[model samples]
Target: MSRHPDLQKFLDRYFMVFLAGYFLSLYAMAGTFSLVWSTYCRDCSREINYPLSLGVLVVTLVTAHAAVVRGRDWGVWMVAALCIGSVVFLLPTYGFRPHMGIFLSIIVVALLALLVLNSKRYRAMRVLLAEYRNKRQVERASKAQRPKVRRSR
Candidate 1:
C-alpha cells in the first residue's frame, strides 16, 4: 500500500509543525510552572522540583523526536524510555501516597509504555545495539585491512 502524494506531503509538513508546537507548549508549561511555583519548588526536593521535571521532559521530547525522525521503528523505545523515566520520578515523589491516584497513574504509564513497546512499528532493542556494533565491527575490519605506514625523521 502506498500513501497518496498529497496526504504524504501533508503528513510531512504536519509532523514538523505538530512537533514544534508540542515542544513550544511544553516549554511554556515548564516556564509557567517554574515561575508560578518557584517558592514551592524551593522547599521541595530536587526530584520533585519544576526544573528537574522540565529537564527530563525536554530531553525526552528532543530525543524521542530525533529517534522517530531518524528511525520510525525506534520511536516506541524512545517512548518507553520516557514512560519509564516518568514512573521512576513519580514513584519517589509520591511514594508516601498509597492512594488510588498514585497507583492509577503508575499503571497508566506502565500500560502506555507496554503499548508502545508492542506497536507494529516497534523494533527490538537488540536491533539498535546490533546496528551500532556492526558499524564498529566494519570500521575495525577496514582499519585492520589498511596498510600501516611508518615515518622516520
Candidate 2:
C-alpha cells in the first residue's frame, strides 16, 4: 500500500472518472463515424472500412484500459498516438466541418495531452506502479531462490 492512502484514493477516483468519460466519448465517436459513413457511402462496398474501424476501436479501448486501470506508461503513449491519428483521420473526412465526432476526438486528444500527460498525479501514479512492480519482482526472485524440501514416503 502507498504511504499516502488519501492521495492514492484521489488518484483512483480521478482515473475512474477519466476512464468513464473517455469510453463514452470514444463510443459516441465510433457510432457517429459509422452513421456518417453509411449515410455518405450508401452505394459503396462495406467490406473493408467497417472492419478496420472496429479493429482500431478495439485497440484503442484496450490500450485505454491498460493505461488507466493497469497503470502502464506504454499504454498511455499508444492511446495518445491513436487519439491523434483519430483526429487526423476525422479532420480530413469532415473537410474542416465542425462535426460532433471530430470535436469529441479533439477534446479527447487535448485532455490526454494537456491534463493527463505530464501531470504530477500521473507521475506519482507511475512511481507507485513502479514500486509495486519492483516489489513483485523481488518476491518472485526470493521464491525462485527457495529450495524445496522433500519428505520420505
Candidate 3:
C-alpha cells in the first residue's frame, strides 16, 4: 500500500486547480491594470492595486492549507514561492525600507512551508494513510462483489 498512490488523484486535481487559479489571476491582474492605467490610475496612486494582490494572497493561503493537510513538499514549495514573490514585488512599492511586516510575513510563511516539507513523520503518515485507504477500498470492493454464476449443462 502506498500513501502516495492513494492521494495521487486528489493531489493531481488540487494542483490543476491551483495552477489554473494562478494563471487566471495573473491574466485578470493584467487586464485590470491595463484598464486602470488607461483610464484613471496613471499617477501610480490608488494603493498599487491591491485587489489582485489580496486574491493571490488568499490562493497562497489555500495552497498552504492544502499542503499542511497532505504533508507534501511539492505543495509547500509551490505556495512558498508564490508568497515570497508576492512580498518581494510589493515591498518596494509599499515603501518597505527594512520593513518589519514584510520580513516577518515572509519568515513566517517560509518557516511553516519548511516545517511541512521537512517533517520527519510526513512520509510515514502518508504511507499509513494510503495503506488505510487501500484496505478500505478492498473491503468495499469485496462487499460489492456479485456472486459468480455457473453455466448450466
Q: Tens-digit lDDT track for model 3 on 8-117?
A: 86565455444444443343334333333433444655565656655665676577546534545565456546544544443443332334554445445444444443
**Candidate-wise lDDT, in order:** 0.52, 0.60, 0.50
Worst-scoring 10-residue span by lDDT in model 3: 27-36
> Regarding lDDT, does 1 or 2 come out ahead?
2
Q: Give a tens-digit lDDT track for model 1, residues 1-153.
A: 999996576466445543443343343334333333443354667655656766766786677656554444465466555555545544443434445563554546455545545543333333443465677788999999999999998
Greater TM-score among 1 and 3 belongs to 1
Off by over 4 Å in 3: 1-49, 56-60, 67-98, 101-105, 143-153
Cα lDDT of candidate 2 equals 0.60
Query: Residue-wise lDDT of candidate 2 within 15-122, one digit each (tens)?
Result: 664554456446544644654564455576679976786787787767665665465667656655555555555555454355666566655654555355456765
**TM value for model 3:** 0.39
Ranking, lDDT, top scorer first: 2, 1, 3
Candidate 3 residue 130 Cα shift, in angstroms, is 3.0
Off by over 4 Å in 1: 1-42, 45-49, 72-76, 92-94, 121-153
Residue pairs with clashing backbones, model 3: none
Clashes of each: 0, 0, 0
